[model samples]
Target chain A: MMTADERGEIEELLPWHAAGTLDRREAQRVEAALAEDAELARRYQLVREELVHTTHLNETLGAPSVRALEALFAKIDAEPQRRPGTAPGIAMRIGEFFASLSPRALAWSACAAALAILLQAAVIGSILIKEKAPGSYETASVPTSPGTEGTDVLMRFQPQATVSDINRFLETNKLSIARGPSAGGIYRVHVSGAKLSKDEATRVLNTLQQNRIVGFVAITH
Target chain B: MQTNSDEVLIGRIAKGDRLAMQVLYGRHHVQVYRFVLRMVRNETTAEDLISDVFLDVWRQAGKFEGRAAVSTWLLSIARFKALSALRRKPEEELDEDAVGAIEDHADDPEVALAKKDKGAALRTCLSKLSVEHREIVDLVYYHEKSVEEVAKIVGIPEATVKTRMFYARKKLSELLKEQGIDRGWP
Candidate 1:
């Protein structure tokens, strides 16, 4: 038998267990208890067996020895027909919302959406196209200097970070705007060119990293 | 009265037969209502919950995945409606007298023996369990939802369902034992 605490737990479990709601751990404990204890098990079975015959609503249905089915259907008919979606007018109105969108607007939206998507895709695609070197540099857009002397770092900006702010940092550090749009969502400045001084790239990358938009940065040779 | 098979009626429901809705509601509503009634332990709330279950079935009948038995799916809906009703309250609970009433309501022999035997005792003792415990068993057995479906419907993790069923069956075992019924069957 379950202790007061155990029984209390068991008591709480009985409803769902009877209703079939117990979580696996609690259920396992209940089962083990039943398996070990005969009285609890017996009570469990008796309740399980009795669940079907209960009729609470039949209090209304019982006495009429007359057409119970008709009475039930009568009740059904009397119910507030909350069948909103089933009505022809309502369903047609919803259908019209789908129908009202002319093919022209949809096609136009699709093309515009696709074009914008492709642009976003291209920016990311170009960035990822290079073979990444572990803790090393792989520049997608060559700097005017074309020298690997400047440290390469990768940075990601926060949502609120603006491309202009990123561009300002790039300009200050002599980092050339690489594959990313200096005008778009994120400005990825590659300070690979000759103008970029030794350790200047790292310092600039670190500065950008502190910026709210620039959430992360990685440095490479 | 012996009811029509859930499988046949369900197929008709899928075909958009309105009468199938009526038949399905007429046949299963009582059990579904009883299940909700036991969990919520209120007559009017149980009725509303029953209607909610049928309304869902009516709207989503075509969406039935047929992954499990129709009765199982119906029970899953019933369990969900009941739980939603249960959650709507601030610290809502089933009172002892209300629960006792459920047990007493089920024990009426005329009602139990209607199809009798295994089904009746299941109802009576089911009321004896706590609202939380009874809810799971009602969904599992009376509604016939599988553990995964029950878990999803109840919005708990899946493992919780097995545990609920374990304790539920233990309770059922005790109830059945009183009637000399052995659930020794697989």
Candidate 2:
């Protein structure tokens, strides 16, 4: 059995260590204690298990409604006090330009040497397609950011679709609009804050395609 | 990789980058909403306050001096709004709502009554904890905030964070024992 003082010290640090919030020095101390004491080790495991249960409980809470998010975006758009774009904005835009490619487009252009040729061809193709239809791009790049690039899924909705309808469709498929309404009405969407596995992304893409209101669904890179 | 860091996002947000705002909102809005939801126990109210919190972030992005993680900053804003809303309403109404909201409705009534799932039992017990204790547990376990971050967000000393969490865990352990799921911690 551990001494009263030793138990107290271990108890104090166990929660932090299990929470993965203990600083480096303190974490090392806890590790040393756990290595030497079976009781302390058992306590640490209990804390870890409890933390997992607590996390699951919290995960059950419902997210804010779609109407709430749309309102937030509309309010943001109406706000007139936007500051001028800076160097970071420019950088982010450049990053977005690359991230917005459809998976098919990425596949066609994955080879670095052929990237320039493929992109030039795709741009020409999009322009010709746009000339044929105002809101249609046979080959267009959607807008996406760094985190969303690899998981980018390209989707489009009926231009006349209601925000409520669109939001419902997106929410149903667990997709979020990352960037879009580009010249061709293409949108770069992702699996909404998740790094979905290839199978999962494919599943999301398939589910989205089943939605009648969603015109086209394709997983870009 | 570093470009998407919270500080960078805040920097872009300070420059009124709407895209940056969207990114940040997507990243943290759910957690902030959940935090606020637990406090006030009203979904609509929580949703409204979440928007309010982000609007505050949009307006005050420039004021963020990197003293705290973006999550910590957001929770601080959320907690403030939740408390203010609670103060405006009658406490008894909130207490009733909170109790109702925390119960998991998806479980079978018979099973829940006889013996709750560990998660449901824990949540039911957590709902009984004082608002102070609940938030502390939420911050550490769900939000994954460091003790220091919890202290900074809650405006308590680090030592106090540990003490509160200790007591909160003890309370939880007792509740779990009462439910026949004891792990032997005192």
Candidate 3:
């Protein structure tokens, strides 16, 4: 009968020996046993072979097709951008949903602007020739700066101008403008007036063919 | 096809060459991915973590001391990331859909998809080994680090390293035999 320590040592040696984990001394001892004993070497080979074959099977299972990797990458790209403790907000979700919205809205807006410019030219002709004012109107705009969105503009009706009048006011003063959000909210004008002199503000003020209290200056011109 | 060596690729990536990054990613992503998947067992999480690994490489390639093989350093990064990901959200679910996607990838496009599969087989087999024995085989055979290096990595005697190697290969061979895989190369 083997002593407890000897039995434990052999047992400890078995897995490593079978798998070839033993260092030279331990390996030599195991090998010497194998040299004197066929059974030990056979057992070692058996264990090693099983490990090899099983690993091979795993390799087969883990093999993914190229289409699969691309699909995986594409899937990763499509995963929702989420943070650790919070769900994504609605506004962003909406933008993501509408990410592919066509330039149709922009084109239509441009057409409307061009038409208004034409109509405004006609109105200006009438006013210049007839020397008379038309009915009441109001003016406002939505913004489209390539930066973080600011407070949304709500529709405001000034008693002195139409969309054409606002457009004219902006054009004459070199101020950009927003008509309105098609979804919701009012039209507003955007004037990049940082460092704008009081003289420049006064020029824009006088050029206002429509009504709007110029809000805060966003950046210094 | 012949590819640039890992060190050269790493140097280029460190220098902020986007093309070099693309090449390096192409070469190592799958291997690193396989290693991560094995450690974490969650394919989607594993996939996500590998990106962090690559990003670190891109950011820190300049800091690499050239002390270890690119593979070893990469595996080390992967190991750290997988552990942290697991620690942060111990319950992070393996996205079944993402895993399915990975399965599909392993099946089709990656020309080396076959190699990753083989690596998976090796990983599963390695998992069956004791942790001590596992590291040795992983560092030497799969990651292909040398014995002296492996000894230094595991902080054990060289003799202990050889003994562990003897047993690791022996057991691996036996396991392969039982599974009807060829145990020894012909």
User: Which has the greatest TM-score?
Assistant: 2
TM-score of 3: 0.39
Strongest candidate by DockQ: 2
Instruction: By DockQ, rank the candidates, best first.
Output: 2, 1, 3
- Which whole-number lDDT from 0 to 100 does residue A3 have in model 1? 66
Deviating ranges (above 4 Å) for candidate 3: A1-40, A61-221, B1-4, B91-141, B147-186
- Score candidate 1 by TM-score against the native: 0.37
Question: Model 1 chain B, poorest ten-residue lDDT window?
Answer: B99-108
Q: Which residue ranges in model 2 land beyond 4 Å of their true spot? A: A1-3, A74-221, B1-4, B95-97, B100-116
Task: Put down candidate 1 lDDT per residue, B1-186, tens digits, no spaces.
Answer: 232366556545555566977778776666666666666766666666666676666556555555565666776787777777778855436565464544343435543463354455555455566666666665655554555666666778655665765666576565555545566531
lDDT of 2 by residue, B77-103 (tens): 999899899889875666565755454
State each model's C-alpha RMSD to the native. 16.4, 22.2, 28.9
Minimum summed lDDT over a 10-residue window in model 2 chain B is located at B102-111
Candidate 2 C-alpha error for residue B166, in Å:
0.1
